[model samples]
Target chain A: MTKRSYMAVPFVLGALLLILTGYWGYTQNESRKNLQTNLGNRYQMAFLDLSTHVEKLQVLLAKGLVSSSPEQDLVIFSDIRNEATSAQGDLGQLPLANPALTRTNQYLSQVGDFAYTLNKQRARGKAPTDEDWDKLAQLQEQAGALNQELKKMEVTVADGAFNWGEFRREANEELAVKGRKRGQINLVKLERNMEQFPVLIYDGPFSDHLERVKPRGIKGKVVSREKARNIALQFVDKGEEKWQAVYRGKVNGKIPAHRIEVKPTGAAGVFADISIQGGKIIWFLNPRTVDKENLTMEQARQKAANFLTSRGYGKMAPTYSVKQQNIAYFSFAYLQDNVLVYPDLIKVRVALDNGQILGIEAMGYLMSHAPRKIPEAKVSREQARTMIHPRLDVQAARMVIIPTETLKEIFCYEFKVMLNGQQFLIYINALTGQQEKILEVIDTPNGTLTM
Target chain B: MKKRIGIIITGLALGLLISFGVWQNQEVTAISQSLYWGSKGPNVVQLQQKLKDWGFYRGKADGVYGADTFAAVKKFQQRKGIKADGVAGPGTLKALGLWTAETRTTARKPGTSRGVSNRGDITLLARVIQGEAGAEPYIGKVAVGAVILNRTESGKFPDSLNGVIFQPLAFESVSNGLVWRHTPSADSLKAAQDAINGYDPTQGALFFWNPAKPVSRWIWSRTISTRIGKHVFGN
Candidate 1:
């Protein structure tokens, strides 16, 4: 080939490379713009939905206050509950950081839960008390204020003066920078306004009373760090291999505990949390991989039972066992006089390969276990059986103490029934003969699970 | 000129034959591909819908084959007196009336069961744990999963697992698409199962963030519960 032709070939290749680069850049820009538009639309939709829901919540609360009829009040309260929940969900979908909207989120949750409780009361043929009306008035006022704040933001959004995409970018950039300026958007201002709502004390899960509940099961004197270490070692180390206990740190939460790391010689370490109050092992995990399944699930259950007995867990009845990855997780509830105390529940994980105790979680047990005066059943078991649907064929029945959503324990007659080849567990309140809860029992190849 | 034309025709015929052979080979392999846990496609959607119609599956037939689909497939297999492996192989597909004329049977090793009854929940949680704290210690992974669970229980966050995980900006891994990009390790799955079983090392922490990484300054306002591995947990 001629030298001139070779030089022309280089130019041609250079031109092709430029064209390819331009095409790639164009596609990248188009895709980025598409993604930004999609995200902006989502944020805008969520914000608008939140504003509408809040407005509806205020209206519903007002309607609830005016409605004296139980039937009308029930519908109004349900609407308020739904609107509040949707508003909370929409608020969660916004781009603001979680801590920025903590108060606002909490307010929405309490409002929704309070409405739910009122709905339940109205369903029970009870009229709203004067106190309930006062709480409703207070909540309605707060909802009005929240709706007003959202309206102001909505105006800016409607005027195209605020762009969630740009706000998200700027907020993320500000978060990355140290000593960043705060409150570029009015969300922080709105969150501050949310802080003035009255603290709700109700029978709901989110009630302030529930947050302050102390552990009913932990009753011993506070143990020293040395005693906690000894308790941890004794609970975790079952074999003869010497293990060293290293104090990790003290963790203060629902159950105040000292974190201890236990390691055998030349082996990887495991961590256990020992409760400071009773010096009992709250939970421990051995993270070793179990690659084989030599022991059956029945054998694993036996191993779990033996482990619990050795640890002084008396009369713990195995309720269910779920097997996963060569580890069988067995749930045991304390059995008191043939009445299963489900609130005092313990979970044990046994490796199916060697029947070794892999893990133990006793938080539920620790939170609720106590020697209690058993209550007499006012309603007979036969009476409770009559309350069940005729379609359900009763397979078994027993007395049990089940905890309500608010952690209040109630004695109930637990009946295992079958219908259309499906099994279900129905709990009837022993005193009132009211159907409390029904759980479907799903027996899969892995193990039995209750839904 | 006639001889050259004849040679060209022969070359074209040879190329057509080879292309047809390749196409046939591709069809055979495609037919042998089994739908198992973590598989996703239109075929999986069909399988799930078929299982649902047969009253064996109760989960949403959204196409992605997960633990629920696996369990349902196993149940169907058991009822049909086939091998009770949680995989949609040719025999199982044929039994479900999903097999086509081009489909072929191929033996495959059964996928190991993760053994949890709520397989879908654990799988999703495990993905989040794997993406967020895959490099952290075992306890740290479990702590991250526990934080997600605690968020579900907290009134300030969404009440359901899916709602909490998929909430906008709640998890950085979800926001950045990292959670879906990687398969969960066995250890991560175990950690998720442990968290679901109520083995919380964080003692009910609602949030966790890696101190070494750039995080929102707002998270600093939360009361720190514990530091596990590189992540600082708070409620």
Candidate 2:
């Protein structure tokens, strides 16, 4: 080739490179802008929806307070519950920090749960009591205040006082340590206003009263770190392996516990959490890989029962066994006076590879295990059987103490029945002869699950 | 110019033939390999999808042959009155209607095994753990998974695993696309399964954040539940 042609080729290649770079940069910018616009639109939509829901909630709460008839109250309460749930969902979708909206979120949850409780009461042919009316009045006032705050926010959002895209960027930046922005500050203010929400005590799951429940089974003096380590080391079945236990730290939560890490010679570590109050092993996990199935499911269950007995869990009866891979998960409940205490339960995972105890979780047992007063059934077993549908084929009958949604224990006659080739466990309240709960028992090839 | 074009066409055809030959060889090798626990590929994906369609598998149809797929294959084999071995060997494949001529060339081998009870929840939780605490200590990874579980149990958050994880802004990893972009490591998966089995090293933490990073000042208001690795957990 000629020297001039070679030089022209270099210039052409350079121009092409420049054009490619420019095009790539232009596309990247366009896509980034598109993404920002989409994100901003999502935030705007969620905020608008939240405002609308809150407005509806305010009107519904006002209607609930004025309605005297049980039928009208039920409808209004249902609407209030729905609007509150929608508002909560919308708030969750926003970019605001969770802590700043903790109180506000709690308020929304309690409002919806309280409304649901009221609806159930009205459905049962009971009108709202005076205290219920007072609580509804307080909730209505709070909803009005929240609606006002949202109205102000709606104005600021419409005026574009702060860009959501920028707010999101600022929210997620790890190094942007400075004063709060307009949008976040507004949310913080709203949360501060919610700090005065009246404490709600009711029969719902989200009631304030449930938060103060103490563990019924934690009944000993606090244990030291060394003692906790010893308890953990003794609890884990190392079996001829010299395992060293290390105190991890003290964990504080619903059950304050001492965390211990046990490492065997040249093996993966095992972690055990021992409750500090009683030095009881809350949970322990041996994360070793089980690569072969050498034991049957029955053998695994036997091993689990032996492990529990050795660990001082008395008279634990296996409720279900689910086999997956090389492990079998066995759920056992404490049996008291021939009545299964379902609330006091423990889960044992036995590796089918070598019949080894792979893990154990006793949080449920620790939370509710106590010597209970076994109430004599006022309704006989035959009476409870008659309460079940005539089509169901009664397979077995037993007494059990099941936990209600509010965590209250109820004595019931658990009837295992079959109909249309499907098995179900129907619980009839032993005291009142009323049907309490029914669970469908799904029997798969691997194991059984109750739903 | 016509002669040169003819030569180029011949060369292109020859290249195509060689590439096709290589592709054909790879396909044969892939088909001949038996799928068992820990095996991963398009074949495993197909196996899992087929099992899911037949109501034997309840796990996601990811390609990796984990415990879920192993148990599913075993269940299918039992139903088909096969040997009831978990490995998808030539015999098992033939029974599954996935057999090919290439699969007949290889002999069956015993396979490894592991298991999880709730396969669907474990997979998603494992991905979240791998994304958020993949580099953290093992306990830290479990703690992250526990936080997700605790959120589900709390009345303030969504009631189910899917609802809690998919709630916008609930998890940073979800928003950043990290959780979905990669598969969880084995340790992360185990940690997730452990958390699902109720091993909460954090006891019941609802929130966790790396203390070194800049977080919202309001986070400090929550009582500190525990600290695992670099992350400070709180209620």
Candidate 3:
């Protein structure tokens, strides 16, 4: 070979060696990582499995105790014994270098022996005698106690609560000395601490609190306006000394109305005014209540939700809007979009028992809901009239203007209905040609009907 | 010349063989360590055997590692009334048998009867009924529960009672793990079994909700009947 070629050969050979070594190293490292991860997952899963089994066995034992089902007790005991054996066999494969776990395993074996004997006897048609039950119960209690103790140990290990090496050494020391004498710690407390988190409570829209605080009298026996005002004041102040009442008024006759005023103790000029008519809230007058600049949609939503939930109307969802001045306002419905949250009337027909809320038609919620865009007219009032049963006598038929609850628009529609005999209401989807909703009314008192 | 050629070839072959042997040995070592540390292979195999022994898992222990093993594991979990995930995690292993050596004493703690677990089961069943047959009576709820249980019995759903309960939005409570919160009352269990036996008061209803309130329009397309609670039941 040429001298230069001979020299190049060694360089090429060295490069090849480097590449091969690097590839092998990478493969080995990757393999080790994968193995370690799999092993960790397996161990964790195994531990959890063991925990669940113990939990079930405990539950079964409890059932047996309550029902005094010796058969169930026997089954539980046998199952537990079998589980304990299987777990031990699985754990043998794990390299649980921790001494606490090792000691725990040993105790587990002792418990297993106790359970196995009881189960074996029970399976042989010998029900756990009272004495046997007592022994089993004691074992169960001890097992639960030990589990708590071990779990604490596990947390410490998993959370790196202590140095593993030192903790292991200490555990080993504890095991070697008092070993079985290690008493159970209060695990409930530990778990509680571990699980504790935080929640936020608000103190705004204070006027709405009246809705929650005021007690309702049966249907509409005249409610004292004075009582209602005091309740509203109490709600707005939330019993805060810093708040002072400013103004109150009543506008009434057709739709009864009330106006109320309040002033903050320290603030000047700024005040709150509210109005209610026919026992329904009409308007709220707090400049701060309307968010101008620094408010987010989420904040507005939360405020609305808070207002509704606090008012005992926990289910109502409110919509928010920005007024002309860029101030945000909130409004909700007794009947939400296409859904009758609060029915004006609920009619039920009971067949079985006293009665059930068989048929509930919320005409008020439907009529009072937000208007929807008019659906395409398919069947005119004349066509709808044809579909009605001839046997059903028509009392009233008119083309009156009504708001569309589903479409959120205004429309002219027809109401051709009768309340003469078997109560039924036929609603025509004037926008669409289809029958919107048919409600069969039941003739029964509100109190008499089972809800 | 021929002898020299043979010698060079033999040396090359020996080097190649050594390299291949080392590579194979490394792979074997990796696999063994993985098994030692708690690989699925070992855990799954052990769980399958335990379930078969317990009569919950009937699939052959071929060790191919698939859904059958999961189903068997789940069945064992359901019968034991444990939360079922087919993998033989520590919980499954412990349930199948007991672990005595690590931290807690290896003895199987006799299970406790928490008055709470039973009550919790009632709530879960109530929630399931509400979801399945809110408008229907006890019969409707019972039928829905039975359908869920039937799915468990057949190969279609996760076999464990919990697996069936908690099979991702299959039943709302099951998805939320609220099924675990419930203690299965004898009545509820009976109802579930009854529904599984093809006695559908709902006549194979897969969905139900209050008719007084607005439901998804899709529900209208299905043949709907049988109103209970506040909902309409349908297949």
Candidate 4:
């Protein structure tokens, strides 16, 4: 090749090398820029999270100040403590490239120490007095200013509008001042007091449930039924009085359950159960009023009979005591075609001497009260036979009017199906063609099972 | 001319490589310093916020690693059941919700923690006593307090603190954490602190009440010794 051509080739190669160098340099620069930019973005997000937590604490403290209840106070204090701990954790995880933030964190720690001491003191029962309050207020004011300054710095970094170099220099200069404020938070008095107060109503369930339910943590322990009953009565009386504030008219049988038992008041002693519920007397088994003052066994049976008559049961009959307990039974009869359905039993246990109503079990009354209206067979006894799984073929299904309550009616197609070598009575909603409830019927070949 | 061109190419290549190496070195050093000192970067700022949420970093979340930030780091370590080292290294940063830059692509969810539970009334009582008098000077005094609680549980001490603490040599502060100038931390509170800090100054000792002023040594003699605080921690 000619010398001129060789020279031209060298020049061309040099130009190519220059282009490659420029691209590599540009890529490297861009990568570095991207890293810095990502770092900055992460910093802003972290700052925002920190400030938001502070705001949350401020809200909690404000609420606590207004409420002044031990329960509320404990909850808010616990939240504040938790938030502070979390904030500290987050800050530790970050790359605080700027030294100023490190100093700011130290200042926050001091303030946190003060707050913690305050909470502990309040928990102990001895809250900070006026002088302590004044000092705390001063500390809070300083913290507020620090928070504002941090916020401003955060905004500057976040927006990328401020001169980063200048901000860094200024932050460095302010570092020393922040450090001086660190140990200045002398909250020992508050801490010592917090260390002393025994706050019984604490952060979770015990406080939350009792407060939300508005149930008095009644201080009592009654072992006997009579005592439990007396407590129930007292609870009803007090509840009645409390209900006057905004009386939602008393609805019968709408009382909240009264769960009574003795529990620890603190470490010292257990409080007796005298808690009220729904402005009603519940769970204090007042058998005397139910058994003695109320109707006698014969009288109650008569009353129950009259009650059935008032409701329209035409052929229902009452049978007097035949058992050794002198219990009375009330029965009703219904007929479909020529078959007579055996009536449900209303067993009443009465005191033999005075004939007081000891207990009245009226279950069959619901079944007997409904009219006998069995619908025409929807899927003939043969069609329903198809829906039953082959493994559990239907043995027999009958149309029957099952009385639920005296006032309610259930025209059911009761199907007897054998499942896994066992028999089950499956009741279908004759109207909807849906299975409602099932019962496992245990009947020995010797007939041990009864309804 | 060819030799001159070759020399120039070699010189340029060497200079470029050296410059690239210097830049790389500087970038690495800057990152390491930024990370070590918890520089006011995005991750640091977020870390600050997370710490605040978890009740650790109480300082402004400005992303700067000043004294307050370091103290907050220490506090976080204390809370996280880690060594209370102030430096925010990889472990501490990960804990604080910051990932090592190298760990960026790994995709981690931040700031979830598990805690310990102290169960039962008797165990709870032991925990509270441990928290309060764990730092007491006399082991016997701490043990005496536990003994009083034990005695209360037994048929011996009056069924209440007023009865047991008021009894002769039962407690140095018949009026402590409640009546005295300082109230001890609650049983649950102490348990929480212990679960986090592992500050088991009480050892396995159950009994503890102060004995700085006086205590019936006979009560102390009935129990085995375990050191906690200035008092004796005993069962």
Candidate 5:
């Protein structure tokens, strides 16, 4: 080839490279603009949603101050709760790590919680007390201030003066605060304004200082980790051949417990939770699946009884059985001195295909299995029988303690009777002779249950 | 001693036949967080519908997992002998026959599910009625079928036909192995179909039983509305 032609080729290649680089830069710039715009839209949407919800929240709290009817109070409280939650959620997505934002989140959370507790009270058909009324008035005042400040900020943002790109994920906390310090987005000052807001504590479940019930069954001396492991292994394996249990240390909860992992030979992992003081197995889960159905439910129940009896769980009566696939779950209530103690319950899941115990949950038994003095029935069976309708035929009766509607435990004479070919249980209060509860005996494919 | 030895050998053989290699792989749907009280999402909607289908929930399935939904879930969990915590985690959802997103696409086809949907329900119902009343006259069998159908319609009982039949301890034959052990007869299938088609042979009987079976004295007080074959029907 000629030297002139070779030189021409090099020049053409340089021009081609320059064109390609220009095209690439143009596309990158285009995409960058689109991406930032998309993010800005989301931030703007959340900001608007947050500001408007806070306004609605203040209005609802004001309405709550005037609402006399329980029905109207429920509606106002529900709106307050919804507004508080959505505002909190939107603020979290704002990508602002300013400690000022943390106060906002906390304020919203307390608002939501306060509304929740009031609504729950309304659900039980109760009216709010004077204290709740005062709290609602204070909340309305605080929310009104916050809503005004947010509305001012919203106006500034709508005027195309606010830079949402500054609060992007890439921006640091310092940069976000720089705007707040300059009185641009004065959320920081607004947050500090509400710092003296009451903590909004209530008798709701999440609040601290609530009466936490201690486990009554945890009455023995603290056992060694090794001993706990061995106890767990015993519940895991019934055969004479000793199995192994791996100690997983202590777990702290309402009831303190030692954890153990018992993966028996030729079996799946079985996680066990044993009480630290009594060394009792609170719960154990054998995460194994069985397919074919080999043993009958009766055989499985017998196996469960044998397992319990061998482990010193005395005279347990099977209360309910639930079957899923090839596994049959039996919940046995511990019988104490001929009385069926429903509180002390243990669940045993047997693999019907192999007659192997797949899982055992003894939380009920562990939490409430304390020896109690068997009180004689104040009302005799003959008297309790009179509480029933004349047409009903009596079948079986027992003395038992059952839970009441308001969380009280009542002792009653539980009469299991036949009502129109179906079975029903009538629990008559032993002391008062009033019918405490009547449960229809529902017969399922697996077992009988009183509902 | 020889007979005892023979019995022991027979038991061992039976045990081996029963237990050898019965493990089947279960499809576990991953759930990062449990769906509990105050938890709201699409997943909660999935949970509500499943529990509703199983005769648990009574309210509208409006997808808001509210307090009524929580109570229904707790009742279902109690029936399943589980924690009864009212949380629809992976295990609870699976127990109620809901498939996760991935399983919905990969494990099943659109047409395949609809094919087996009520076919299984009807077949199981037919088998139950056949086993319970096969020995009685054809009218008695239809009456038995009618009772189950009526239960599905009754607001006091479960809504679905399968729910009413499979409700815990609903039928003695179900617990006693007569239902599962027997294949459905043609007459029983026809009776089931007739019952589903709104045939009220027993004049809206909620229950029926053979008087010779030595039931509770309360059975006699039901004011026996009709008697077909050896069975007495009652509302």
Candidate 6:
């Protein structure tokens, strides 16, 4: 009878255990479903908001296309701008893959910027041209198409026939299959139906024609990437018998160049921006701190000038020197006929412990180094000296090609003076006798910065 | 319970009276001698100048301390929320920017102090102020001093007073033999003191330079925070 009771007890315990496990699992599944529903609701809201914004943007663009009054035009254009902006913001909030949305996003951003530019021009009492109106019409059509696509997707989502979970999972899996690295998970594939979505070209900031200034100083036979890498290796190569340079591709900027990163064996080296045409080293940097400083600023300055001279930079004069921690940096502008050419600037950073060249940048030299007619100062130093305040005790003076606040180059008489016993540099416009600017030579604990 | 409450009240009253005595003792510096109706000599002349500059006195330069000067002193003292006893005392003088030697918060003894380090950070501050902003307006000098102080607080820069001052490629004065050889002048020391005391005219500038220099492309890329004197302060 006791054995029979034991068997019944086991049976009862087994049933209870099975029921508990099933209940726990059901609760967990229910909570997970609840969370997913919450996520889906958020995505649906974003999608709905996105389509609504895009539809409004299309309507505003249509209004902009026909508006004749500059006052009404300004108002319509501003609305179009705000609508496009909010549409982009709504699109950004959605976790949609960007690959499908990059060009579309760009199109919206440009439309906004274009509208902004038109509004500004109208506000300035200028009339919009025929091309601008045509562009606005074209923008309205493209926005309508994008709106249609978003609306269709919204409908499918609302019907519960489409699954966002599956779409997101598939996109991630697609990225993995394609072997795309970091940040690619956020990219979703859009329906590929943009065959002739006109690459909108306008006078806005997003315009493709923004940077057309060819490299002014990069003049020589065009070299291949391999040759450019070889030049960089030779230029930075010192003491190390074997040094390899990694070729990072071209810089997609106003003046494109090949980027080469060099790391010597067991020591960090500098990056070199070599021109594709001349293969000149435009810039270099290796910020490995030299913890022990044995050399002073004078010694470091001499070492930097020597390094540049060895690298075929002819007759460079030290313009400024600053030392911080155990490193010293020197700016050396090219010298022609005992006159310092400030535009052709070359910067050198020296590790002061052993005076090793840590970095060298010559972007100014490489980009603005073409032979120029250095203009003679219209105002003589003596005449300019007379214009300064009586409290300014003149020290040294030079004729420098100083850049105006507007970034335009102008010849000026640069004068160094002591005011109230503090050193100051004053630049007077050589032609106009106008005091262009004054710089107080500020001394700090480690280095000095002119303020 | 009633006895304990009475005891507590009596103890509190005694404590408050003793503390008040201590506070009064501190406030009564002997140099703050109360002056009235009839005083004379150099101290009066100094007091008269301060009151006149602060728009309290309209009298001409005179060696004697008179009724007009006394009245002006009283008015100035009253305006500054001090005892209107017509005394050119330590507290009142300090308020008028005519602080005396015996009662000066900024009368830091001239020495190499390690406020943050043994490398003479205070001296270095003074030297840099003298070297860089020696001729700048007093406020501008303070702004220049605060820039380095701000740098020491940032994660990108060195954390110590010595590290910020002696950082390589940082100060032209350091490299160009200005800071190392500079002797801190009176104004420079005061500027450094003001800056150390948290008077930042730069509004937390990490970098400053004249807009006239061939400033690097990287420096120009920094967002400007404020402009003081000829220097553009940037963060």
Judging by TM-score against the true structure, name the best candidate. 1
Clashing pairs in 2: none
lDDT of 4 by residue, A141-182 (tens): 444554554555555555666433333233234433233222
Per-model TM against the reference: 0.82, 0.79, 0.25, 0.27, 0.47, 0.45
Candidate 3 CA-lDDT value: 0.42
Q: What are the runs in model 1 whose C-alpha is more than 4 Å off?
A: A1-12, A175-185, B1-117
DockQ of each: 0.23, 0.18, 0.01, 0.02, 0.01, 0.01
lDDT of 1 by residue, B1-235 (tens): 5455446555655565565444432322123467999999777877877888789999987979998999999999999999999988889988887775443233121111112326677788999999999999999999998988888778878766777888866778897999978999999999998888788899888888887887767778878889988999988
Each model's C-alpha lDDT?
0.83, 0.81, 0.42, 0.43, 0.68, 0.66
Q: How close is candidate 4 to the true structure, as a TM-score?
A: 0.27
Give the Å error, residue A184, model 5: 6.1
Instruction: Write one digit per residue (lDDT tens) for candidate 1, span A298-387.
Output: 888999999999889979999988888989999999998988999898999998888889889998898888897888899999999999
lDDT (10s digit) by residue, model 2, range B1-235: 5456446555655565565544433332235557899999888877887788799999987889998899999999999998888999988887777776432221211110011235566778899999889899887898899888878667667656776787766688898899978999888987886676667778778899887876777578778989988899998
DockQ (0 to 1) for model 1: 0.23
True contacts kept of each: 0.49, 0.37, 0.00, 0.00, 0.00, 0.00
In candidate 6, what are the lDDT values of residues A145-262, reduced to their tens digit? 8877777666676776655555544443444223332322222223334435876777665553432334567888887889988888888735545778888666433335677777
Q: What's the i-RMS for candidate 2 in angstroms?
A: 9.5
What does candidate 5's lDDT look like per residue over A252-317, in tens digits? 543566777776466545667777788887666554556689898899999999888887886899
Worst 10 residues of 2 chain B by lDDT: B106-115
Candidate 3 residue runs with Cα over 4 Å from true position: A1-6, A97-103, A119-134, A149-451, B1-235
lDDT (Cα, 0-100) at A24 in candidate 6: 54
Candidate 6: tens digits of C-alpha lDDT, residues B1-235: 5456446555655565565444433322222443445776555666676677679999973746788987898898888899888866667777876564443233222111112321255567889888877777665677798888876543234445655665533566764679856688766765565455344545456788877764555456666655656777766
lDDT leaderboard ranking? 1, 2, 5, 6, 4, 3
User: At residue B91, what lDDT does model 4 achieve?
Assistant: 78
